[model samples]
Target: MGVGEQLVTYVTQNGYYIWEEFYRHFLMAAYGVLFASIVAIPIGILISRYGRLSKWVLSFGSIIQTIPALGFMALLMVTLGLGTTTVITTLFFYSLLPIIQNTYVGMKSVDQTVIEAAHASGMTRFQLLRKVELPLAVSVIMAGIRTALVVGIGIVAIGTFVGAGGLGAIIVRGTNATDGTAIILAGAVPTALMAIIADLIMGMIERRLNPANKASAASQ
Candidate 1:
């Protein structure tokens, strides 16, 4: 059969399997980003407060980013074992750089005038951050999260190597078979689609969170 026809056949026959793997893939990626955000955002905020530490913290995150995904997972596997845990943990480390960097930049980007105004109003440090800085920085923070998630989707494809399953397994199966172009495309097509959908969704959320966009919409 032709590659196109075979692709259709494979997808049709494996609809449930594809759907299950797709769900698993998204969950792993999403969980990794979520976990990273919980830690990274707070650290980012702290570093923004203490400017001296920003360089060191970002440097460490960059170092982590320099590590190859497969190698990183291999190291984690020694403790986490061969499974989704290893994949998720690897993804978490991979996700840290963009998020922390963005958060720091976002917080620092907030207008000093606005911060001064908040302080003049007798707002405490915590209140100023919660009420003023966070709102202004939220869109930029969201942009970082969006980047992390889209990248994580791609990284999760490698999870199959660790026995984490996902569409990568299908791709691997295709590689093992003779003339498995159709099976490979069957896996690849969905992976690409997932990344595209995630980008679009996150882009929308980022736009919505943007203060300038909100102001423009309100004026309209």
Candidate 2:
């Protein structure tokens, strides 16, 4: 078939395949983000509360961030074998640095006076975190999530190498077929779209969650 005809056929035949690919990776990415957030947020809060550990945790997470994605994936594949479990695990680890760093930074960046006021108001530690600190830190935390989502979407293509099917499968097929253009467009297009959509959605969540935004809107 001609290239145009081929493109049309591929899209029509594999639209669901593309969506499935996107969804699988997207879900995996979400899991990774959630895992990272769960691990990071509490640690971040602890560091913020203690002040002394902030530097150490931030430094440690930064070190993790320096480990390349492919390197980590390779190591996991060697130890865990190729599959969804391995891919998800790899993505989760890759996600940690940003989430932890951002959560720590976000919580630390919360205004001292706000925290002091919360304490003066008889807010317990949990109450202060839930009411004052977390709400204030949401934006920065969201920023980290955004970064992880985008990075995860792209990195998920690597899962193809480890037998975790996704859009990466298309790229892999195109590669084996020696179709450079197919590989490029097939992999690049959907991943970019997914990342863009994910970021926009997270941004909306961040805006909605931001107390300052809500207060301003209330005033307006």
Candidate 3:
């Protein structure tokens, strides 16, 4: 059959199963990004407070980012074995740099005068961070998250190699089965859509959180 015909047949016959794979693929990325944010954001906050340490912390993350994704996942497989745990952990590491760097940059960008004002107003260090620094820096932080989310979705497709079932499984199957272009597209198309939709949603959220965007809207 032609590739196009094969794709039509695959989708028509296995629509429900395909949807399940799509959901699994999404969950794999979503879980990684969510947890990465939780872990990295705090580290970013800590480094921001101790500016001397920020360079070293970010350098480590940058080093991790430089490692090839598949190679790192294979390394994890040696100790962790296979399946979703290994995949999630690998993807989690991939998601960290953008969030950590962005969070640090965002909070640091808050005006020193504003910070001093808050200090003079009797805010504790934690209070100043919670109320003043993080709020202003939220846009940059969200931008990092959005970047990670899109990147995570693409990377999670590789999870299938380790028995972490996702849409990538279909692509792998297609590659094994005569390099069927149609079979691969069934998985690839949806994965691309997930990236697009995630970016759009996260972008809207970022713009909403940005103070400048809010003020511009109010002015109009």
> How do the predictions measure up, each by TM-score?
0.99, 0.91, 0.95
- Regions more than 4 Å wrong, model 2: 1-4
Best by lDDT: 1
Candidate 2 Cα deviation (angstroms), residue 69: 1.2
In model 2, which residue pairs have backbone atoms overlapping below 3 Å?
none
Q: Write the per-residue lDDT of candidate 3 for residues 27-46, one digit (tens) a residue.
A: 98999999999999999999
Top TM-score prediction, candidate number:
1
Report the C-alpha lDDT of model 2 over 27-132, residue by residue, as the tens digit.
8778877887788778777877788887888787777678877787878888899877777887777777787777878888898998898899899988988888
Model 1 Cα lDDT, one tens digit per residue, 1-220: 7999999999999999999999999999999999999999999999999999999999999999888898899899999999999999999999998999999999999999999999999999999989999999999999999999999999999989989999999999999999999999988899999999999999999999999999999999
**Considering TM-score, which of the candidate structures 2 and 3 is the better prediction for this target?**
3
What CA RMSD would candidate 3 show? 1.4
- For candidate 1, give the lDDT of residue 212: 98
* Model 1 lDDT on a 0 to 1 scale: 0.95
